[model samples]
Target: MTIPIALTIAGSDSSGGAGIQADLKSFAALGVYGASVITALTAQNTRGVTGIHQVPADFVTAQINAVFADLEVRAVKIGMVAELAVIDAIAAGLTRWLPKHIVLDPVMVATSGDRLLAAEAVEGLRTKLIPRASLITPNLPEAAALLNEPLAAGEAAIESQGRRLLAMGCPAVLIKGGHGQGAESIDYLVRDSGVIALAAPRIATRNTHGTGCSLSSAIAAGLAKGEDMETAVRYAKAWVSAAIAAADRLGVGHGHGPIHHFHRFY
Candidate 1:
């Protein structure tokens, strides 16, 4: 039995809502074997994060080496790297392994529109890591942060940002418009070929804590299963939409709860 495998290099959320937990859940839900390399440990629940303990850069490198050394990892999703050194270590690991697909969710901006990474770390990420990704998935504020521009309020501006980001060395960029106000949530997949707009009906629910992490991991799962970039992205969006639609049933947390990753089975 040849099961596809995907790796997630990210922080661990104690609440199991976001970060590494969400990534692993998304991988399993999508039928891909999951492996992980944790960069940090976060004290967080659905309400918010309270504390974080970053793993030492060398230890992070060790974890990455351990996973890549054993697993037949077909794709990788990266998230929540808190330090410049950690970013450097992750970039080094990617350079070593050369995974077929690398999905980078630039998890630098929070839902409250706050910067999560230090300025230097952000610069390191921009320079060293972004160029190595097969695709970068950035929310509106994150994309703006990467380009040091104002939030794009329309399609043309979003595409322009995507194009600029693509020039930053990533072959493709997914500009997610979840922060935008509308009946539909739209995400743009910008490649040299053109932009593909993926839209889904916006679900009204507070239980969306892990949406970005899960979406990117789902994309990794699809890629691990041998889907093309567009197909993987389309399937991920649809799957995440359904998970968000079904999130209310979980009743897990008081504020911004997690989506039901296993919504299909239970």
Candidate 2:
């Protein structure tokens, strides 16, 4: 039996908190073969992003080609698209390879409140990438970007928002409710069949920097291993919840930091 392959197209987190680093960590933790195409390299830490260096669009394409030409990648997760051209490059690569599943985590604002994607890239991502996604995972602010509406204050404040996102073209949508002011982190998954909601108590910690990226990547890893969507999400939610609970209080920042992924096994 061969190990299933999974690809993560995103940025690099120097602190190993978010973007490609976090995705790779989640994939390895989940026992999937992980590969990365770094879109941008950020001088980031738990404190925040101080500067960013975007890989040239052509190099990004080269990285994609290098991976797909050699590996039987089964699923892809896209995040931290630093520029419109990078997003276009990914779309072009997918146009040819057409992997079995694509999960788009519309990562716009960082946990530290730094802008990761250019303002112009949002529209391009919607038209070029969202439709290609088997699952589009967006938190409250990201849903607002997709819908062009003010964010719903909480989960109850936004009913059918996932349905609205599904209508936009993605076959399925997962609207994350972690950022919602609440005692629980409830995520609503909406598809043609109906809505499936999962709720768990929110941990009282700030080490949640890569929670979204980790969740989406674990889902992609699940898909690569041929798990159904619901099963993938169920496993991913449980995985991320465990990761969050085991977070390290190591950094001094107003915002949260990364978790200890291997705490249990180590």
Give the alpha-carbon lDDT of every model.
Answer: 0.92, 0.89
Give, for candidate 1, the lowest lDDT window spanning 10 residues: 109-118
lDDT of 1 by residue, 4-27 (tens): 999999999888988999999999
* Candidate number achieving the greatest TM-score relative to the actual structure: 1
Model 2 clashing residue pairs (backbone): none
* Tens digit per residue, CA lDDT, model 2, 26-120: 99999899999999999988888999998999999999999999999999999999799998999999999999999999999899999898889
TM-score against truth, every candidate: 0.98, 0.96
Any idea what lDDT model 1 has?
0.92
Compared with the true structure, the alpha-carbon lDDT of candidate 2 equals: 0.89
